[model samples]
Every structure is written in structure tokens, then in C-alpha cells.
Target: MVCLRERMKMGKRSEWVAFCFLCFSLSLQTIQGYKESETARTLKLEQGDAHEVHCSRERSKAAWKIIEEYLMPFVEEERYQISRRCRLHSDNDLYRDQEQHKIHVGVNEWQCGYCRKRFYGENYLDQHFDNRHYDLLNVSHSRCLADICGALHCDLVMDSVPRKTKCNPAAAAKNQHLCESLADTCFPVNGGPSAGRLHEFFLRQFCDAHTCTGGRKPFSRGHRKTRSIFYLFASILTLMLLALFYIFIYMHRRGMKGGTVELKRISKSVQKKKPS
Candidate 1:
């Protein structure tokens, strides 16, 4: 009976141990799942760089807004080397022999190629500096320069090899001519009235003030006056035609007496052709 009692206690202890282990494992799995889920959500938000990026989770909204409003502004004042790396299943997932391990998520680690300073998060490395170090920026320099290209400079080439030395002089001259002609002919009150006036007006309005000056009286105004005069002559001709049209309508309304009077001012054959 004592042996039986000892066996019962051992069995109960074993069952209790098993239950505790199971609960511990389940809790660990839940925590790990949460971590992976959060990471994926963060990645999804980061991928939306084509549009304004925002965190997917509502809990992260406050943090993201704070970063944008506060952190982003401050970052501009400081020198930084920010880079984006894709967090993949593995660093060398392609080379992984184990199929089960191959399909795992991997956190991308960033390091300054120059300084070899490592960072876990992209934001942390963004404000990387070289106060104590010398020439620790060869790797980050390429990315830093890339971000500044076109956005910060009037002339920026994405390609490693530039396509042209400079703009073709003949092509530039042609564009200049077309631009000037459009400015002269299409602008209201200054030149030949063109159908493209509205488009030109909007273009001038929206064009960058630095690149395209507005409200400045063009040097070609004098030359454009010639075309304006032609427009004026055309307007006069139209007015004359309209005046004759009104007169003809009035004369018809005034009946045969007006027609007879008009015929007397004309030849016999033309007079006969007049309306009775």
C-alpha cells in the first residue's frame, strides 16, 4: 500500500509538470506570434512609401505621428545616413538547406559600410554622425547623395554614366524659339490671338517662380506688337463684315423702298438681282 501511494504521488507530480510545461510553451508561442505580427505590420507600413506612409496598427499611430511631426523636422537639421533594407526570411534564404528554416522571417541589420557601426532599426542610423571618426561615410554617401538628387538640385542624374555632357545647343535654341513664340502669340492683348492662350496662361501661373519668372514684361514685347497689330486688323475686318451684315438685315426689314435705294447705288444687272 505504501508503494502504491508513492507511485500515485509520482504520477500526479509528472502530470503537473507536464501541464506546466504545456502552459509555458503556449505562452511563449503567443508572445512570439505577437512579435512576428507586429514586425509584419510595421513592414507593411514601411512599404507604403509610394504614398504617405502610416502605421497599420492604431496603437502605433500616435508614435508615427509624433515621429513625423517632431522627429522628421529635427532630422533635417542634423547630418544623417538613412537606408532601407528589406527584412526577409533569411539573409541567405536562397542558400538555406533546411526547408523549415528557409521560410522564416529575418530582420535586416544595417551597418555603416564605412564605420562598420551597426544598427537594428533604420531610424536609429538616420542621424549617424562622424564626430569622433574620420572618413566613415563611403557607404552611406551613395545613398545620401541619391536622396538629394533631382529633389534638391536642378540638375541630377540617376544613372552612373551621364547620358549627355550638356543640352544640345540647337535643341535648346529651338525650344527657346517655340517658348518665345507661344508667349508672344498666345498671350492676350500683346500678340496674335491664339487658341492656346488659356493653356499658356495656366502654365505660366503654375510654373516655378525660380525657373519661370512671371509678371516680368518680356523683352520681346516690341516684336510681339507687330502680331498684335495684325490681330487688330483682323478684328477690324470682322467688325466691318458684322456691320455690313447688320445693314443688310436692316435693309431687308425696311422693305422694297430700301432695296430700291440700294439698287440705285449699283449697276442695272446687280440691281435686278436685289430682293423684291
Candidate 2:
């Protein structure tokens, strides 16, 4: 009986040891996997930056097809086609004339695809689209698109795809998992690309590449102007306060002198009036 009890205790001890070893191995594997993923993401970012620089250098001379080929792997197919079209329309006068004839009745008019509304200009169309069609168009896909592009270290191409009647069920189902995986591998927990970040990135790139009317300025000119105005107003206010302070001091001194003079005059009168 005593020998059997001792063997059972030994068996339990061995099982506990095995469990701990298994847990330790899993933790080590997880750590290594995380490190490898981080390294890969860093490499991808470096490569993307190099690609962007090359694109910028060749942007003036390179054909749309060549640019598309270079960017195709990094962006979605729909986005690539839209970007290609936009480039062609902007660069080729013939293409622009043809598109304008087909799409615009006037020099500064465009039709909205969703509501068939006529807008006076491209900016108006853009604003209308954002206000009226943004939710109906993007829905759930925007988040997935942003996360995927972020993970791939690519720019998010906007206004590329048409509005969908319904959200993509498959994409919706997998979006959470994809976001989590991307966060773990490509971005920090707080730094992952959301819809706003993707929009910001697109706007920055657009401003850098094109010269659209009223587009965002590269140097934060508005912010600088605001700061300058604030400083000017503050300086004026300080000067005004200093002037008021000096006037108050001058008036107080004058009042004191007047009071002293009046006292001297009264004393002189009293002395003259006294019997001498």
C-alpha cells in the first residue's frame, strides 16, 4: 500500500512538470513570432518609403501604365484603375476634353453618381458625396480596407469603388480578426490605421502630388497665419494694458501734485491773514 501511494505522487509530479514545460514552450514561441512580425513590418515600411520616393521622382515623366504597374501590387484593383483614370484625365488634355464632353455640360459642373444630383464643381461633388453617400457607400468595408492597406504598408485610395447596396458579408465577418492580426503584426495597439488615419494619409499624398484648387497646403499656412494673428492681438493687448497703466500712474501723480499745491496755497493765505 505504501509503495503504491508513493508511485501515484511521483506520477502526479511528472504530469505537473510536463504541463509547465508545455506552457513555457508556447510562451517562447509566441514571443519569437511577435518579434519576427515586427521585423517584417519594419522592412516593409522601409521598402514602401523607397517606393514612394521613386514614384515622386518619376511622377512627371512616367506614364500612367508604368505607375499603375508599380503600384498595382500594393493597392486594390479597383483603386488602381481609378487612380490610373484620374492620372490620365489630368495629364492628357484630349482625355480631359473627351471626359468633360461626356460628363460635364459646363466647365465647372459634375454629376453625382449616387443621387444624380448636379453639382457646380468638383469640390461641390466631393462635399455632396461625403455628406450624402459616405455612409451608404463605404459602410463596413472602409475599416477593413484601411486595416488591410495599413498592414500592407500602402496608401489608401479613396473614391475608387462604387457604392454597394449591401455590406460584404465575408469581409465583415473577417474584419475583426484581420484588424487584430494586423495590430499585432504591423501596428502598435494605439497606432493602427483607422478610417480617419487612412483619409489623412490619402489627403497628404494627394496634396503632395497634385495641384488641385483649394487643396490642403503643404506648409500648414493657415495654422501659421492663425498663430501670427493671435500673437499680434496678444501684443496689441499687452501694449494697450501698459498704456492704461501708465495713464493711471500719470493721473494719480497729477492729483497728488494738485492736492499739495492747494495745501501750500491755503497755508500761505493763513500766514498772510495772521496778525503780523
Candidate 3:
């Protein structure tokens, strides 16, 4: 009996130890997985900047075809085709011919697939599609035709992708997790000489390439004083002018009332004297 009891106790202890080990191992695996996912989420993004990555589509016919194919599903297919074809015309022709043609075809509202808001004209619709639907940065505009797509900061691309380092140290320090570099990425559409400068100008305006260092300008001291003085002088001048006008009106009315009262009193006195 004693030997059997000791064996049972040992068995229970072994089982408890095995259970504790399994729990620890599972916990460690879960923790590791979580860290990896978190790292991936912030991997390319700089710290202080909005999360953005800049990817370029290789400048080839194949690339544009692929982008158009992917973009078709998220966009109204016929509308996109019209816009793409219109891009071939010179600016002058686009303004003169394309505008008239689009109007003749009927100015119709197109609803956004994501937001479901309708836009009035083709110009507004084109702007809406670019700003709302294909607004993501890291993924190729082609890749973003699908509903779930990554948004990369244009600033990140401006600072990191082309240079492969933070051009602005302050912005990088603030948003360390937000920047990623894509090497030798060429923007096919922008291969023209003017395209590079234009893109850089746009990137500076909208990208997270730098930190916002200065506050908005306050009202100037001279302007504030001038405004206050003008207000005070105007108020005093208005009161003085109002007082003069009021006095004139009161005097005019009082004189009229007095004259009428005097005339009635004199006529009554004269009649009373004669009738007696």
C-alpha cells in the first residue's frame, strides 16, 4: 500500500511539471510572433511622419498595361479608358476639344467605389479618384486598385527611396519607424527632364520629408494697435455724430409742438374775451 501511494504522488507531480512547461513554451511563441508583426508594421515608416512609402513602376509599356488592368476594377472602366486616352492630347487640345466632347457626351456624376460619393464632372472625378482611391504611396498605384492597399508617405519616398537615407535628420529622428528605401526605382511617367523637378516640388509640399519647425505667424504688433485705435476713434466719432443728429431732431419736434400749443391757447383766450 505504501509503495502504491508513493508512485501515485510521483505521477501527479510529473503531470503538473509537464503542464507548466507547455504553458511557458506556448507563451514564448506567442510573444515572439507579436514582436515580429509589430516590427513589420513599422518597418519602413519614419517615426514623426505619416506612414508612407514611395514605390515607382518601371517605365515600360508592360508596367502601364499592368497598372491599367489592376486599376479597372476599382474604377469605372469606361471612364478610366476615356481619361487615359485623353492624356495623349496637348494641353491646348485637351482644353479645347476634350472639354467640349466630354460635355457633349453628357456631364454625368460618377460615384467613388470606396466612399460612394458622386462627383459632378470629369475634372472633379479625376481629381477625386487620384486623391481618394489611388492615394496610397508605398504600393504601386497599380497595386492599389484593390480595396486593401498600403499607403506610404510621399515624404518618405522623397527622403529615403531616392537618397536611401533621411535627408532631414529632425524628421527622421521623430519618425524613425516610418522611412524605407527602395533602390533605383524609376518613375516611368516622369522620365522627362521636367518631371523630376516637378515631382520634387510636389513632394516637398505634401511629403513628410521635414519636420514642421515653426509656428504660424502671430498678428503683428503694429497692425493690432492700428486696428484698436481705429475702432476707438470710430466709436467716439459715431457717438458724437449721433448726438448732434438726435439734438437736431429733438429741437425740430419741440419747436413744432410749442407753436401748435401756443396757437390753440391764443385762439381760446381771444374767443373767451369776445363771448363774455
Candidate 4:
């Protein structure tokens, strides 16, 4: 009866152990499944982020291509038309005769009121006003005008009165003078006005605020010097990297050679001992 009771107790202990093992196995499987699910969720999120970035990059590329292919030519053509119109009006005999008669009649010869300097025409006077009195004009103006005229120095004009009709030749010439003056200020002649320089100036001045930086800093000798210095530093860094790589290769080859010599010496010594 004692032995039978002992056997029954052993059987109970074995059953309990099996139950505990089964529970532990189930817990481990549950923890592993949770980890796998979390990992998959994280990977999916990363993939979504990567896809978004790729789409953004593709859109940017497409936009740049459109600007380069279509928008640039259109801008160039508009600039050409502006420049041609300015040239034609500037050379007009009727306008020149009118200005000459004004000067002959002692009508002040289109003089700048601020500087008291005389100009041959209204265009030159407008240019002087833009170059010299731009700051004063801005402070004097009570309100800002809408950018409908597409002139850079139009901002300097104190008139906030809206126009009901399209600007005539005289008004257009005045706007052109303003544009040219602002262009000169923004893009000073490094030598002289080469082809397309004026166009670039106009584009910079009249471009959308969101697209352009407003010609804040003109390209100058200082920028060129800075670029040269940067290139010099980059070249020096590349040469230093090459030197380090060469040194690493040399050291690795020397280490291999030394190991080969040591092995050869050991093998020879073993052979000698065996023959003796």
C-alpha cells in the first residue's frame, strides 16, 4: 500500500512537470509572434516613408525638366522683346525732338530734383532717380503698388494709383527705364552688358518671391575667390585620402611578407629536426 501510494505521487509530479513545460512553450511562441508582428509593422512604415521620398524626388525632377525645357525659352523670348522695345523707343526721333524742344524752351532738361543733375531725356532722369534715390522713394511712398507693370524699379515709384487702361508707349518707356536702372543696380557691369545679362537681371528682379531670392547678392570677385578656395581645399583632401590608402596597402603587403618568411623558417626547422 505504501509503494502504491509512492508510485501515484510520482505520476502526479510527472504530469505537473509536463503541464508547466507546455505552458512555457506556449508563452515563448506568443512572445515570438508578437515580436514578428511588431517588426513587420515597423518595416511597412519604413517602406511607406521611402516610397513617399521617391515620389517627391520624381516630382522635383519633373518640375526642373519642365522649367529647363519650356519655361526658360519663354523667359528668354520675353526678355528679348522687352529689350527690343526699349531700344526702339530710346532711338525714336519724335521722342528725341520733343525732349530737345523741352530743353530748348528751358523746361529744366529732365533734371533729377534730388541730385540737381541734368539728363538729356526722361529715361536717363528715371535711371538716376532709381540708382540714387531708391531708398528715399521707398520711405516716402505711403502704400505699395501691385506688380502689374513687370518693372524692377517700379517699386521705387511713389504712385499707388491703379491704372484703368494698358500703359502707352511713353509709360512703357518709363517702366523700361525703371527696369534697366534696377537691373544695373542688381547686376553691375563686370565689363559691359553682354548678351543675356540684362535678361538674367530682369528675371531675377521680377520672378515670383517663392521662386527667386530677389537678387540680394550680385555675383562678384569675392564669390569667385571663395569658389576657387573651396576647390583647392577639396583637391588637397582627395590627395590626402589617396596617400592614406597607399600607406595602408603597403603596410598590409609588408605584414603578409613577414608572415610568409616566419612560416618558411618554422617549416625548415621542423624538417631538420626530423632528419636528425
Q: Top model by TM-score, which number? A: 4
Q: After superposition, how far is residue 172 of candidate 4 from its true place, in Å?
A: 20
lDDT of 3: 0.41
TM-scores of the candidates are 0.24, 0.23, 0.25, 0.28
**Can you tell me which runs of candidate 1 are displaced by over 4 Å?**
50-276
Model 4 agreement with the true structure over 236-261: per-residue lDDT tens digits:
99999999999999999999999999
Summarize candidate 2's per-residue lDDT along 109-192 as a digit string, tens digits.
788655578878866765564455444432221212222432221322232464434434454335434434432332233433
Residue-pair clashes per candidate, as listed?
A: 0, 0, 16, 0
Q: What is the lDDT of residue 156 in candidate 1?
A: 22
Query: Who is ahead in TM-score, 2 or 4?
Result: 4
Q: After superposition, how far is residue 205 of candidate 3 from its true place, in Å?
A: 29
Residue 80 in model 4: lDDT: 36
Q: How far is candidate 4 from the true structure (C-alpha RMSD, Å)?
A: 33.7
User: Candidate 1's residue-wise lDDT over 159-214, tens digit each?
Assistant: 34645454355643443454444333333333333324432542342221113223
Please give the lDDT score for candidate 4.
0.47
Off by over 4 Å in 3: 43-108, 111-118, 121-128, 131-276
Candidate 4 residue spans exceeding 4 A from truth: 54-62, 70-276
Model 3 quality (TM-score):
0.25
The true-structure Cα RMSD of candidate 2 reads: 24.6
